[model samples]
Target: MQFDRKDKNDATLLDLYTQLLYPRMVEEKMLILLRQGRIGKWFSGIGQEAIAVGSALAMKETEYILPMHRNLGVFTARDIPLKKLMAQWQGKISGFTKGRDRSFHFGTQEYKIIGMISHLGPQMAIADGIALADLIADKKQATLVFTGEGATSEGDFHEAINVASVWNLPVIFLIENNGYGLSTPINEQFKCKDLVDRAAGYGIEGVQIDGNNILEVYDTLSDLAEKMRKDPKPVLVECLTFRMRGHEEASGTKYVPQELFDLWAQKDPVKCFEEYLLEQRILTPESIAEIKADFKAGIEQEVEAAFLEEEPVADTATEMQDMYAPHPYQPVEPNQQSAEIRYIDAITDALKIGMQKHNNLVLMGQDIAEYGGAFKITDGFVDLFGKARVRNTPICESAIVGAGLGLSINGYKAVVEMQFADFVTCGFNQIVNNLAKTHYRWGEKADVVVRMPTGAGTGAGPFHSQSNEAWFTKTPGLKIVYPAFPFDAKGLLLSAIEDPNPVLFFEHKYLYRSLSGQVPIGEYTLEIGKANLIKEGEQLSIITYGLGVHWALSYLDEHPEINATLLDLRSLQPWDKEAVAAAVKKTGRVLILHEDTLSSGFGAELSAWIAEHCFEQLDAPVMRCASSDTAIPMSKVLEESFLAKSRLKESIDKLMAY
Candidate 1:
C-alpha cells in the first residue's frame, strides 16, 4: 500500500496526491455545470482518476501521452492551464480547437499530448507513429496510449500492437479495464480471461495491476518506462478499474447495479490515495484540507473566467485558413525536351527526388522496404533511404495510415502506399476521420501523401481495379490528384509531397507501363487545383481526368477536325474552376467523362456545376460518358465494355453537333 522508493521522497508522494486530487475536483465542479446546462456534456473519470494521474506522473516530461475521453487527469497532471481546459469544454474561442470540437477531442503539441478521436481505437496506431519517430531519432522517450478494455476488440488495437511489437517501438499500451463499455460487461466484449492476456498474442510483455492503487500503478509504469527508454520495446499494462458514472451524463447509470456502485465506493481511487497520504504522514489533515479547498477554488475561478471569455463566432472570412497548411501553388512549365519514360518510372523518379531533397521524408507500405512495394515503384529505395526512413509495415491499413499521421504530427513528411488502391477500404477510417479531420479539428498538419494505384485494367478484377477517387473526393479535408501522363505524374507527386495537407495521389495502374511520355528528370512540382489544357478549341469542351484524359486525347487525334477543347483536370477536389468556367464560356457545349461508375461519380459533380453555372452559355444539355454502374469485371473484354471508351467519341460527336 506504500511506495517506499528511497529516491522518491515524502514530497514526491504528496505531489502525486495533489495531482490526483486536481482532476477529481475539476470533474466534480464540471458535473455541477453539466447539471445546470452551463456546459454541454462531460465524460467523468471520478473513481478511475488514479490510472491517469499515476501513469502521467510516471512519464518523463518530454514524452507524449495519447489520452482517451475519460483520462482528464492526464491533461491536469501535465498542468495544461485550467482556464484553457475549461474554455475547451465550454466551446469558447480561447480553447485549443478554437471551438471547432469539444470534450477532449483536441490535442496540443506544446504539452506533447495527442487527443483521441471519437473512434476510440485509431489513437493506438497514432501512438506507434509517435514512438516510431523516437525510435528513428534514437530518442530515449517512450509514449503511453490509454484505451478501454472494450476497444480491444477493435481491429486498430490489434494492428497497432502488432506493429509496435514488430518494430520494437517504445510504447506502453495502457488498457483501463473499466468493467463495462457503455452498458456491455467485460464478458460480452471479449472471450479472454483478461485483456492483458491478449498481449501475449502480439509477442510483447503484459502486466496487470490494481488500477485504484495509485502507488502500485505509478511504481509499475515508472519501472517499465525506464526499461523501455534504455532498450526500446512495447509493453501492455492492463489496469483493473470501474467506470463509476454513465458513459456520458445523459446515458445515466441506471443499468449499473446499485450494489456494484456501493462496493466500488469503498475503494474509490481519490479517497484511498488521500487516506494513504494521511496514514503515511506525507501530509497532515490541515494540509490535505488546504490542498482540496485550494483546488476547488482554482477550478471555480477558472471556469467563471472561461465563461466570461468570448464565444466562437461562425465567421466565413477566416474559415478556410487552417484547412490546409499554407503551400502556394506553383505553375509547371512543360519540358518537351526531357527524355521519355513510362508512368511508373516517372513516379519512381519523383519519390527518389523527394527522399533526396527532404531529409525527413519517409515511405511506409506493405513490402515497400525490401520488396519495393507490389508495383515495384520503389524498387531500390530501401537501399538509398535505409530501413529507418523506408518502413515496411504489416498488412494493417488503419494502423499504417494512422502512423503516417503520427509522423506528420512529429514534423515529418510521410508517403503511405496502399498495395492496391482497393485495399484502402481497410484504412478508410484513419483517412476520413483521423488524417482528414486532424487539421480542421485541432490545427494539426497531416502532411501525408496516400499513394493509391487505381483504375480497372490488366484483368485484375473488381477488388484490385477500382477507380476509387470518388470515394475520397467527397471528403472535404482531403486533396485528390489523378494525373494522366508521365510528366504530370512526376511533377504532381512532388507537388503533392510539398503541400502540407492530406493528398490522395491516385495513379492509374493501366497507365503505369502502357503510357510513356517525355518527363523532365529531377525535382519539379506542378500546380495542384489547376487543369492542363492539352489541346484548345472552340466547338466543344471535353472535361475529364485520369484515364479519361488519355481516352479523350486518342479520340481527338483520330478526329482532327472536331475542334474540341480537352481539359485534363489533375486535382479532383479543387478542380480548376476558373479554367472550367472559361472553357464552358468559350465552347457552348460540354462533355464530362471519367473511368469511374456513372452514378455519384466525380463527373456528376462537374456536370451539375456546369449545368448550374453555364446554363446561359450552353448550346445543349451537358453530356457525360463513364463506366456503367457495375463493379469492374476481370475479363478484359468486359472491362473495356464497362469502361466504354468508345462512348467518349460518340459523346463528343453529340456535344459538337448540339
Candidate 2:
C-alpha cells in the first residue's frame, strides 16, 4: 500500500480517527443531557460517523454541504465550533437560529453548512441548484448533499437526481443505507438487489462501499471529489452500514431483532477504527488515555457553559415583519401613462425592471432559456441577461422550487416559473411545507417569487389550466397575488420580487395575451394587502378578483341601474379585509365571485370571514358565483357553457332582489 497503515505515525489515518471521534462524544453527551432533562431529544449518529466525516472531508473549506440530521459529525470536521452546536441543541439565544429552531434545524452560511428540514429529500434538489449556481459562477467546486436509505423513496429524490443528471450538475448524493428506515427493514422497503444499481438508470456512476471502514471511505471519496471537480457529473454512492442505536432519543430498538443488533455491534465503525489505531501502535496507552480524558472533560465543560446562555425572548413587535415580506408599495421611480401593452409583455417588463434594479436575481423554469418559456413570457430574456441568470431547468417542478429556495437563502432573490399552474402540484411539498414555513420557523427570509401561469378560459384541459390560488391561501406565512389588469401584474410582480418572503404570483393564462390596459412602462408597486374599489355604489358589493373582475365590470356597465360596488382583490392572501368589511357593511348585501370551484374556493374564506364579522349588517345571505367542481373540458363549447356568464348576471339579479 502507498500509505502504510502499519506505521504508527500515518497522518491520514490519525486525522480520520480524530474527525470521526467528535460526533461520538457529542452523541454520548446528548444522551446525558436527555437523562437530566436539560435537552428534550437528539438524533444519534452513533454508527454513521465515518460516512459523515468522509463525505464532508471530500470538499474544500469553501465548498458547501447540506447535511441530514444524523450527519452531526461533519460540523466538528468542518470546524463549526462544538459550543455553537451545544447552544443550538439546548435552544439558547446564542444558537444559529437564535433558539427559534430545535435539533438539527439551524445552520450558519459563514461555515458553508446548510441544516436539514424534517423532510430531508427536498434538500437534494436544493443542493443541486446550489451546485448550478456555483457552476455558473465558475467556482469549480462540488456540493455534498446527504440523505438516508428511506429518503430515496421520495419523489424529490428521483426528481432531483434526474434533473442533476440532465444538467450534469456537480453534486454528490451520499446515501447512508443503515439497513432500516426508522425500524422498517430495507428488505421490506426496497426490492432492488443493490440500491447502487439504480444509478445506471440515470446515466450516472454508482458504487457501494464499506461505510464502517474509515480509511476506505476517506480514500475513496477524496479521489471521487477530485474527479467530479474536474468533470461535473452527479454520482450516487450508497454506504452499507447499520444503526447501533434506535432512530432517535425518543425511539428505541424494540423493533430491531436481537441478532441483527448484535451483528452490527461487532462492526461498530468507531470501535473498529479505535482497534485499528491500537493495532498500528499509533499511540501509547498514556497518549490514548490523554485524548479520551480531553474529549470527556471538554464535552462536560462546553455543555455546562451552554446551559448558562439565556433563552430567546419573544419579540412580538417584529412578529408581523417575520411572518410576511416588507410591503414596499412606496415607489422610487415615477411612471408616465403609456399605451396598452400585452399582459405577457407586462410580466416580462416587470422581471426586467427587477433584474436591472437588483443584481442578485435569478430565473428558473422549464423551456425558459432558448424556447422563451412555454408561454414565451420570458421571450428574449436569455439574450438580455445570458443563460446563467435566465436558467432553463429540467421538467421537475419540485427541483425548480427547491433550487429557488437554496438561491434565495444564499443572498440571491429567485423567480421560479411553473410552466402550467396545475403542475405546481409536483412541487407542493417545497411550496407548502418548506418554502411557506421558513420565515415562521426561524425568521429566515424565503425571498423567492413563484410565478404561476394560472386560470382557464383558453379551452385547455384540466391538467394544463387550474386556479390553485385558493389552495395556498390556507398557509399562514405565504403571500398570494393574482392580478386582474396588466398594470397590476407589472406593479405587484416587482413588489413580489423585492419582498423579503416567498410570494406566489398568479398570472391568468386567459389574460396573458388577450388582456391589456393603459399600463405604464416605468417601475411602480401596489400595496400587497390592498384592494381597489373600481366602482362604488349603494345597492350591493360584488367582491371579485382576476377574470371575475372583468366579467363583473362588463355586466355592471350594461346595467347601471343595479348600482353595485366592484372590488378587485389583487392580493389574495393577507387580503384587503378592512376595505371588504366597510363595503359589505355599507351595502348590506355581498356577492363573492370567482372562477374556482364554488365549494371551498378562496371566496368561501371571504364569505366565512364576512359572516363572522358583518353578519348583523348584511340584509341577505352571502352568495357565490363560480364553476362546478368538475374537471375542465377540452371542448370550447362545453367549457364556455359550463363556465357561464349568465350565472354571474343571474346571481347578481337575485342578490339585488333579495
Winning candidate number (TM-score) = 1
Residue range 1-658, candidate 2, lDDT tens digits: 1223533357777777778887888898788878888778888889888888987887888888888878887888888777888888877888886776787786567888877788879989888878877777677888888889999999889988998898788888889999888989998878998888889999999988888887667767777778888998999989988887888868888998899878888888878887777777875567667877888998888888888989888788665556664454566453776768988888999999998888779999998888999999888888888888998887889988998887776668899999988999999989997788777666567888999998888889888767889889998789999999988899889888888788999999999888877878688887788999999898999999998898899998888788888899999887999999988987999999998887788999999999999999899999998887788787888787666354888898899889
Model 2's alpha-carbon lDDT is 0.84
- lDDT (Cα, tens digit) per residue for candidate 1, span 431-485: 9998888988888899999999999868999999999899999887899999999
Report the number of the highest-lDDT candidate. Answer: 1
The clash numbers for all candidates, in the given order, read: 0, 0
Candidate 2, poorest ten consecutive residues by summed lDDT: 1-10
TM-score of each: 0.98, 0.93
Model 2 residue 189 CA deviation (Å) reads 2.5
Model 2: CA > 4 A from native = 1-13, 36-38, 98-100, 312-320, 325-330, 356-359, 615-617
Residue 614 of model 1 has an lDDT of: 80
